[model samples]
Target: MVDVVACGELLIDFTPVQQKEKPGSIAFEQNPGGAPANVLAALSRFGKRTSFIGAVGNDVFGRFLQQTLIRLNIGTKGLVLTEEAHTTLAFVHLDETGDRSFHFYRNPGADIMLREQDVNEALIAQAAIFHFGTLSLTHEPARSATWRAVEYAKQHQRLLSFDPNIRASLWEDLEEAKALALKGMAKADIVKLSEEELAFLVGSEDVVEATAWMLGQYDLQAVFVTLGEKGCFYRTRNNFGTVGGFQVTAIDTTGAGDAFVGALLYQLLEVGESMLDIPQATLEDMVRFANAAGALTTTRSGAIPAMPTLSEVKSFMEAAR
Candidate 1:
């Protein structure tokens, strides 16, 4: 059985890099990206069997992304290549603090073209967890496809993992985006959100209050709010706590949150439905390991390339202690 199955956008990220030949000029480095894909990459690094269900263009970038997944040992049986549109591209701009923003080149990218027919029900049924993000909900056929897969996974009793991973600029209406994200959250068994996303969704700055509201609002097993280098706040129905982060001199924050989600899911999958009953200490340790994974991803540059191996995360955590 597949350990995890993710359905959503798979695209290229053009991360800014310093041009060595010309010191003042900057260059863009192509990296395999997309929140769902990055999460699978992180899981793959930890020796989990993962599969992707999404669409890409029948172009160079699409081919590259497919190969990247294969190289990462993630299954591609559900990945589709289409001629209708080119692959999606995002130019990443990093500030002095390694925090980043994106400018997208996807008016109708291939990812958005994913049809309900492209969704692999068999793949979803074979997985222990079904993971997705809201990016695919921004457009048509992909939106329907995502919901179809979600329903199928739910019917099969698979754990549903969600990350809103909202890019407000991609939406025509922020409120619409918010609604869809909340809709997805309501369906998820596990959810991960950035600090900004938590505030945006809950309309509260207090993590404790917001998480309480979320647990009360949704039929969720657990909710994680990632706070960059400060680590994460997590809450389940019965327990809640903060996990302190590892201090890392981050060069790029890309994929860090996905790494945290991946690591947390890896641990959660070990216990399955019992995750809801795990002790607060067990939950904190899981988040601590996930925080280490996220911090380690930032020490490098790209998304998939930067994800640490299982051994690397273990060694980093050991050394930090």
Candidate 2:
């Protein structure tokens, strides 16, 4: 049985190495990416029984994505290869400060063609945690497919996790996107968001106030608010803490959030502690480990390419201490 079943987009990101000389110029390097895909890769590398559900184009880029997931040992039985569409591509650009921006080329991309029938009910039933994101909710068939998976997961009483992973450019209807994303969040047992995402959800600029509002309004068991260089803030009913991020000359912030979430999930699964019963020291250790994993990812280039293995994460944490 898979420990985590993640459903959503699986596509290639062509990240540019240099900015354009002019406003409209283009430059890029192929990088396999997608938020859910990156999380699945990270979980698999840490030896979690992970499954990915999505669609890919019957093209060279899709082949690379399939090979990458299989090499990492993630279950890809639910991945559909379609000839009717091309693979989804995100043109990623980084400013001088290493902050990233995106340009999507996703009209009729294979990922958006995911049908309700593409989701595997047996896999969702067997998985301990069913994870999904907001990107798939931006369109028709994919939206139906992802929601169907979520409903099935809920029916089986499985733990649900949601990450908005919002890209404003992808949605023609921003209000609809926000409503749908909030609906997913309400279904989740665990919810994670970046500082910006939290602000958008709560309509507040203060982190503490935003988190407080979430806790007061939602029936969530856990929530994580990632603070980039400041690290992460997390709360469960009985435990709350913030771990300072590791000092690193981050070359790219591409998959850092995914790495952190993946590592956090891996550690939580290993420990299998009741969130309410977790000791302060153990929480600290878990946060430190996750922070190390995330910080290490930024030192490299791609999203999946940058994700550290469990051994690598352990080594980095050991040396840092």
- Give me the candidate number with maximum lDDT: 1
Clashing pairs in model 1, backbone N/Cα/C closer than 3 A: none
For the record, the alpha-carbon RMSD of candidate 1 to the native fold, in angstroms, is 0.9
**Whole-model Cα lDDT of every candidate shown, in order:** 0.93, 0.86
**Per-residue alpha-carbon lDDT of candidate 1 for residues 183-280, written as tens digits (9 for 90 to 100):** 99999999999988988988998999999999899999999999887889989989888889999899999999999999999988765646778988
Query: What is residue 260's positional error in candidate 2, in angstroms?
Result: 1.0
Judged by whole-model lDDT over C-alpha atoms, candidate 2 comes out at 0.86
Candidate 2, pairs of clashing residues: none
Candidate 2 error regions (>4 Å): 18-27
TM-score of each: 0.98, 0.94
In angstroms, the error of model 2 at 250 is: 1.2
Number of clashing residue pairs, candidate 2? 0
